[model samples]
Target: MKIQNKKTCIAVLILVTIEQVIKIVINNNFLDKKFPILPGFLYFEPMFNRDYSWFNSMFQLGVSKWIHIVFGAIMIILVYLFYQYLNYQFGTIKIVNIMYAFIFSGAMCSLIDKIFWNGSLDYILVNGFFTFDLKDVYINIFSGLIILSVLLKNKVLNQIDDNIVKDFTKYILRKL
Candidate 1:
């Protein structure tokens, strides 16, 4: 791998490790305990979310664990493919690589949560909004980075074409 790719991989591993370590500490010591951070706005209340997502729990979907695993696996693969596509199109843009690292690390951590922990060990609670963890923060950072990239580098967005879909299809076929 190239130096940039190796760096990105290392970043992903470090982020995933940090997230997993935090979850481990919370699970062992702080599960279900509430520690007020902002009193009414934010707090640390560890929660194990068994459902696949907030949408599933909110709608009472009762999605199976196996399904969650499969879906998570597919998402990880798609994220990787998209990352590859971006790299192929842009030739090692540092910001895109960083975005991929954050997003990929978050997705991997989420998959680990579902597969091993049996759910996400969310410890940060935003009162009246949602409960989340480091993985969620990584994803949110990736989202913000992508938005900023688009706003600052509109030419990159305009330059993208349908080749991404075609290349993705070719890649899948080759793998299959």
Candidate 2:
């Protein structure tokens, strides 16, 4: 495998591990408790959603269970295709690879939870908005990045590659 392939694999593994760790912590400690983080703005409200996939809520498709099963399968396949697209479009862009990795791993996490637990685990609540969890956060970030990557052209993506890690590291080192 190439070096980029190895980095991509490591990125996916790290993302999936982080998601699972967060899920385990939420499952253990916040199942029945509601911890308000910002009074009326943000909250830790553990909730399980069983009846539908996340898109169904957004699209309000009211799809049947069989359809949801098919949707899940298709999503897993799309994760593969998305990785291929990323590899072809920006092979050496580590940030793009990492974003796609998170997207795939986050989808896998939610799919596993839906299959085994009869629902996707959602907990964090935003005022006047939906309740979701770390997996959802990963998905949303990936979705936004996908949009930006597609719309903003390669220079923006390259800037992200150049600046994000360096700026983040500088901030962390400054704090340290």
Candidate 3:
């Protein structure tokens, strides 16, 4: 890897570190109650999820951790392959770099939660229709941004229509 590649890795590492730091701060500072800024708008509170059983709750804690590790490894490998493909095709580091940042940020966030706090921490509730936390917001927004970026970057436009061209030629012949 070149210098830029090393820098990119460092950037992703920084993102992971920042995520862990945020988690630590939240877990250590606030454990009492929710801090409601708006009455029905938003609330900040610390919530812990001990069981890492989103779909299945039967398995033990060790099993849950293994599930995450296996999933994370697979996911990281896929991301790496996709990133290489994108970078090679486009000859630009923009998309891959953005993807790296988001993927690492998400991975570190969830990984730390599972390792330290048992499950994931549910904090920073959103008001109005539903409730959410910082981790949820980060994950959702990051995913949306990635999808939008990929769509915009790889969008195909100015497609030639053979039928339209043929029809135009026939119309000109009739006019002549």
Candidate 4:
């Protein structure tokens, strides 16, 4: 692996390790206990969910817990494949690599929870919205970062291409 790749791996490992540690603590200490935070907007409570964060309604679509485990495993593999693809195709972009690391690490964290524990360990509760764990937070934020990095990359590339076209046009006009 290149230096950037190594750094990305290390960063992901550190983040995953931290997330798991926090999850273990929450699981052991505060399972199903709610501690209010930010009045009503946020709260800390450890709970388990067998389904993916965004799949509450679809979870009842005849998907069993064993199937969820299988899905989690498949997701982990897909995340790894996507990261490898990005590395091979766009190795020059460090931010993209880092974002991929975040995404993979987050997915791995959830997979670990799904396989070893009862379900995905969720704690952070948002009033009138949803509940999530650190792993979920990691996945959500890093996924957003991945999208942002791609958009920024495209914008930068477009600007550079536009500048090149303008410069060529100026050169042609001067020659004429």
The number of the candidate with the highest lDDT is 1
Which whole-number lDDT from 0 to 100 does residue 13 have in model 1?
91
Sort the candidates on lDDT, descending order. Answer: 1, 2, 4, 3
Give the alpha carbon lDDT tens digit for every residue of 51-130 in model 3.
Answer: 55344434443456767766766666555654554454345466457656676566666666676767877666667444
TM-score: which is higher, 1 or 3?
A: 1
Q: Give candidate 2's error at residue 144 in angstroms.
A: 2.4
The positional error of residue 38 in candidate 1, measured at the CA in angstroms, is: 1.1
TM-scores of the models, in the order given: 0.90, 0.73, 0.66, 0.76
TM-score, cand. 2 vs. native? 0.73
Clashing pairs in 1: none
Q: Model 1 off-target regions past 4 Å?
A: 1-4, 174-176
Q: For model 4, how does the per-residue alpha-carbon lDDT over 68-162 read when each residue is reduced to its tens digit?
A: 67887787765665455444444546766666677778788877876777577778889878778777777778878757757777643333444
Candidate 2 global lDDT? 0.72
Question: Model 1 RMSD to the real structure?
Answer: 2.2
- Number of clashing residue pairs, candidate 2: 0
lDDT of 1 by residue, 64-149 (tens): 88888899899998888777766766778777788889999989998998899998888888999889999999999999987997
Q: How many residue pairs clash per model?
A: 0, 0, 0, 0
Task: Tell me model 3's lDDT, rounded to 2 decimals.
Answer: 0.60
